[model samples]
Target: MVNIFDNKEYLSFFCFIFFSLFFCVFMLFLSSLLGGKSLSRYKHTPFESGIAPVGDTHLHFSVKFYLVAMFFVIFDMEALYLYVWSVSIVETGWTGFIEAFIFILFLLLSLFYLVRIKALNWTHK
Candidate 1:
């Protein structure tokens, strides 16, 4: 039996951790200190294709645009999951097949519901 309180390995581990933390802190502060403190007026402004800043930086976007983007991401992730399931279907056998089938059906139903609610109708929104 070994006494946990008198471990030399633990002391070495603690020293390693402290050294790592000190190195990270030293590098971060050194990089910040080396950076330029001054900034030009033009540099602060947003450069839109080098045409200069036009109008206000803040612009209101349509809710429909955001909704469609979110749905696209959700669907893309669903497809990715389906692809992973397909790859594992051989190893998982019948149970995995049934589960993935149900999952695909659920996603299809969700897509149908979104379509019914006109979530993808960009022209009308």
Candidate 2:
């Protein structure tokens, strides 16, 4: 029986790990030596594209933006599920078809609910 510990493959693997660790530590030390400490007030301040920031950064945003973003995410997820089903449709046959139809129905129902609640209406104040 051949001993695995005496194998060249095992020695090479350990050498690769040791060299990777050594290189990473050397690079980190070199970068720290070259980089200077940040002392300027402007460097610490929140930069808004060189424009002086007005009012609070945590001010309330439009609800319409959030609503639109949520709608986009829901629809995007539906598309992804449909794409996955499409690739395996031949293998799953009728069952896959029914499942995809049900998924789309639920998506449509959610859209209807959003419309009824005036969530889709951006014009309303």
Candidate 3:
């Protein structure tokens, strides 16, 4: 059995890490020493596109747009998971295929519900 604790290579690796960390901390300290700040009301105020901010940040958004975005994200994630499972289908055999099929069926059912609720309709007028 080899004694890993007795290895010179491991000691040298740790020494390198320690020196790197020390150098990083020293540089940060030097930078902070060079930089100075002055606080003011204008500095604290929120900046927006080089123009003064007007309206409230907590403004209401369209529910339909959010719903459509959520639907897209859910379906996109499902496709990504399906792709990962497809690569290992041979190893997983019929069980994986059945599981993936059921997953797709559930997603389709959800999509059907969304369609019924007019969630996909972009024209609100």
Candidate 4:
């Protein structure tokens, strides 16, 4: 069997990995050794703009918020794709335009479906 250490590339790769791990560990060790230690009461508490935190940190969120967020992300990504296609319109010609039209058609259909299902409605129905 050929020794992996005999190959220059394999040896170099192993050396690089070893050095990377050593550097990370050494940096962490140095930081801990040189870092200051604080045992103040507020050390473990959540702080905001030098103000003490009040009330519960974990508040219940409405599912509508997440639904709207997902819709925004999906539409925003579609917009990005359209922007990219528009930038390369000259290269893609009519074919790109047709494809984009079809994509937009599907987007509109999906939006309509969501509206029909009252997905965007904030009212609890």
Candidate 1 lDDT, tens digit per residue, 87-120?
8888999998898888889999999999898888
Give the per-residue lDDT digits (tens) of candidate 2, residues 31-102: 999988888777877877878888877968898899799899989999899999999999989999999999
Regions of candidate 1 where Cα sits further than 4 Å from its true position = 1-27, 39-43, 47-51, 123-125
lDDT of each: 0.87, 0.91, 0.89, 0.94
> What stretches of model 2 exceed 4 Å from their correct place?
1-35, 46-60
How does model 2 score by TM-score? 0.62
What's model 2's lDDT at 82?
A: 94
Best by lDDT: 4
**Which has the higher lDDT value, candidate number 2 or candidate number 4?**
4
Error of 1 at 91 (Å): 0.8
State TM-scores per candidate. 0.67, 0.62, 0.59, 0.69
Rank the models by TM-score, top first: 4, 1, 2, 3
| lDDT of each residue in 15-63, candidate 3, tens digit only | 9999999999999999889888778878788877999877778977789
Candidate 4 weakest ten by summed lDDT: 46-55
**Preferred candidate (TM-score higher): 2 or 3:** 2
Give the clash total for candidate 3.
Answer: 0
Kindly list the per-residue Cα lDDT of model 4 for residues 1-125, writing each as its tens digit.
99988899998999999999999999999999999999988788876899877778898999899999999999998989999999999999999999999999999999999999999998866
Specify the poorest-scoring 10-residue window by lDDT in model 1: 39-48
> Which should have the higher lDDT, number 1 or number 2?
2
**Candidate 1, TM-score vs. the true structure?**
0.67
Model 2 pairs in collision: none
